[model samples]
Target chain A: MELAAERHGDMLLVRVAEPRIDAAIAIQFKEAMRELVADGAPRVVLDLAPVGFLDSSGLGAVVAVRKSIGPDRRLELAALTPAVARVFRLTRMDSIFTIHPATPGPEPTANRQAAPAAEASLPDGADEA
Target chain B: MKPEPVLAKRPAGAPRHPPDDPAAAGRAGAAGRGHGTTALQASRAPALQAPHCPDAGGRVPQTCSGTLRITLPATETGVRRGLAQVFAALRQGVLAGAVARDAAQGQAGAAEPVPQVPQSACDRIELVLAEALNNIVEHAFGPEPPAPATESRGVTAPGLIALDLSAGAAQLHCTIRDAGRPMPDGQAPAGRPQDIDAAADLPEGGFGWFLIRRLTLDLCYVREPGCNRLSFVIPLSAEDPPRPHGL
Candidate 1:
């Protein structure tokens, strides 16, 4: 899995570079987010646009990341794919954080379109884990 | 590492037709179908059972129900997919029922209204299932293929297998069994992302355990006697509860 982090004002956009956020990448996600937080980025926006799925472990990592930051530092999620979003919805985590839409809304980016096109370069089933 | 032979008990009772028909099928379509559709019917595990279990343990004795069994060579891939399919089917039904129950009770304001489960949930579950089954088939059964004739008959010894499903009131309890050299206690896989090292980068080698832990609400592994039983619970949606009365 690949991850890219860029600063946008006070917020940092961390795009999870993977097709699926099942078990194999859940730990890496926690470590990466911890490092990013330690690097002094304040507000964080997880761009889950690339992730097609998130299981319980993935959910735990996101929750852990949220817990890692101080109260002053805000963490938001963006562009949840349908499959991943279903997990959040099922577990009721969707209510905990500020989720942005595909396009930035009055709030941040939480729920996006019904379905987004797969990345042109990523092959189907490439992200098996 | 030679593959082992496995065996499964045939489904119970006389075969019945699919729910699509309560009555018997026309003679033409019924030709080779024995014990009918309800017994020994080929089913994709995830979509069907789960709503019937009343409690945990996945066992509903005294109820006249058909037993669904599977015996595959001890390959991780087959075991993972097979297990996932069974779980997905149960979870799907349970969740759907839950969503419906909430809707009927007009609990729209209650906790996200149990949003309609997207087809993506089903697909994701299927993928995860496949991964788990593969792990059992490949690793649990040792790094060897089963005998040809043994595979032809389906059961293979030293194979990883499981089948314990009982349902009650929006809950399906399942007990998955397998036969393999145990991998130490507390050595189950974790659901964290793997490090992207040279070897970890391989797409196929890892990820089975992660998915298994993620999708299951409760997972328990026990090694005793002759087999390994991995038991878990998949809560069903309460809208369309399994009609235990029918089974």
Candidate 2:
């Protein structure tokens, strides 16, 4: 549940520093998202570049976070790794969220489902949230 | 955190493998394993009786790929480790299956199909397994286990899961057994798809069985006298590229 949030202009970009968001930590992830979104950003983009696996519990947690943030606010997903992207696609959640290309990575993979990685260029500037 | 005891040692004759031994985990040569293969014949869990397997006495056709049997405590951490070990063994199967297929075709060509488990397939398997294992770990064994050996009718006691996973070139077969409570009506639930159209109050919990049903084939559930058994086969394809969207 190590989520680092950065304000990219009007949007908030939260990078999931964890490789997995499974049943083991789905609650923590939802709680962390709740706290991050407390800043009242209109749009929040979850950087899922590092998450290689996401189970049903993890998927539920993401949905729970969205509901907790209120319907007016948008919770977009960015740079879902191959595995995470597949989970979203299989569960049909991909259709629900507004997905965007990842920031950038040193060397990107050929998997067309996911965008490139982002941790390589994190501006660890103080947490605006 | 108290020291976990080696409470139930499986019978020496069981074909089970230690999850700690990664290299030895895959080669579960259960070809000649006699009648008891289907049942959890272990003396561990003294109160629980032996679970019955349908193919108990019948000769199991030889599975050329890796076969791994793991007896894991029904807990989140235990299921996580079990999934990891099974995933690793599956990778081994994929590699072996690919090489066997390649050599059988009489082509000593360069590495073709990425030589690893398909990314798309791995994701599905991981998600389905995570859902199933987490379901069993959390619900099947009831609430947090009562103090170790105290077994009452309320299901306050946690149980163990014996998992048999085999990865072949064509399909991956899994058989899971536990001493916990059986499915409510002696059958697995029909996990229906959630209506995402419900803008705000979408369901979160019931999606697991839907994913399991969506991803698996030949799914079957049975409640033996003292145990619950579930077996399913997930077909695989080496050359299946990722689908653009859900089917």
* DockQ winner: 2
lDDT tens digits by residue: candidate 2, B1-247 = 3112121223234333454543232122111112211111111221211232224443443442244555556766566656664554443342244334543454557433333344445556667777887788777876583233433332223466667665554566888777777889898988777788777787676788877887788899998767777899765542222332433
Model 1 chain B: weakest 10-residue lDDT segment is B33-42
For candidate 2, the C-alpha RMSD (Å) to the true structure equals 11.2
- Please tell me which predicted candidate would have the highest TM-score against the true structure: 2
Tens digit of lDDT per residue, candidate 1, span B87-202? 33333332233334444464555653333332333344344444455555555665574532343222223544545554433344556655565546635665454442332122
Which CAPRI category fits model 1?
incorrect
Which pairs clash (backbone N, Cα, C closer than 3 Å) in model 2? none
lDDT of each: 0.47, 0.60
